[model samples]
Target: MATHGQDPLLHSEVRQASTGGYFAGYAASIVLMLAALLVTQQHVLTYPAFLWVIFSLVVIALVAQAALFFGLGLSPAQAWKSVSLILTLPLFVFTIGLSVWMFHSLAPRVMPDTMPGMDMTQQPTLLE
Candidate 1:
């Protein structure tokens, strides 16, 4: 229950909105973006390790944004929001992955077999 009147329909289970959390989430997002840029600019890790680190940072940032910025939590009232997000996450990733895979498969088939100006035919000389 809130001291000030809050719309029951909107916030049935009320939680105090925190400016600190919002700022923290924003700062964290900025740091993650800078870290990604640094990772791309400086080759500090091998390919596999570099990819894993970037992926880990991305997942952490996603969670931070979901919790702090979006106010998603595991509480009874908010659990459904979290559940829905989790359910949709895989679908979203899968759709993007599938799109890239399709493009990769499509590229080779559509590419020209040879250079634009090169002629493949063998022309017999007049002496022959």
Candidate 2:
């Protein structure tokens, strides 16, 4: 029987490489998220739709970082982490979808019926 040192499945070099990659990916994700926040705060991307796109990209980056950090190996701990992430993916999608739907549904009810400085209604009609 091969010991851990000589085992085909677990190599010190591979573990080190995986750790380094995970750290690097996580650092990059943090930087990207911060940059996105700064851009939004500065009004560099003022449109709500564009901001949502940026948020989606950040979510994707976060998932990529998690996968890199947790899913690269077959050790028992890594396997558990990967399984948890896989199971949570659907929940994440559902939460985002439900939140967006609720926000859009409630916006008109909460907004004033007319614009502050104009005769026209603040609510836009499809034909307008």
Candidate 3:
């Protein structure tokens, strides 16, 4: 019964993307990115704290993109999708956290402690 040019998946049940929503999502993403760039370039945070700040900003941007672009939300139509994402979020977080941990833990072991131009003796020890 379907027409050759008609796609069943594009039926009324599927939510259409709105231009306003798309623009809002795009703007929010850009703003978040610029904020992160500013924080990094200005040295708003130092070393490990800077990394954490950037990570948090990225997570916020991800949520904004999901809500505006992917239609992820709490409405009846999107409840299941929202719940599914929430359920799987822990796995995603765990995977990324573990990957970072592994890389940091292994780096000192795999790479030389001192660079060619730097003297190991010049570096301060925790006991100092």
Q: What is the TM-score of each candidate against the true structure?
A: 0.66, 0.52, 0.66
TM-score of 3: 0.66
What is the C-alpha lDDT profile of model 3 across 24-99, one tens digit per residue? 9899999999999999889756799998889998999999899888988777767898999999999998999999
The lDDT for every candidate, in the order shown, is 0.81, 0.69, 0.82
Kindly give the stretch of ten consecutive residues in candidate 2 with the minimal lDDT sum.
112-121
Clashing pairs in 1: none
lDDT of 1 at 6: 59
Candidate 3 regions with alpha-carbon error over 4 angstroms: 1-15, 102-128
Rank by lDDT (best first): 3, 1, 2
The segments of candidate 1 whose C-alpha lies over 4 angstroms from its true place after superposition are 1-14, 43-51, 109-128
lDDT of 3 at 25: 89
Task: Please give the RMSD to the true structure for each candidate, in Å.
Answer: 7.4, 7.0, 6.3
How many clashes in each candidate? 0, 0, 0
Residue 49, model 2: Cα distance from true site in angstroms: 3.8
Please say which candidate is ahead in lDDT: 2 or 3: 3
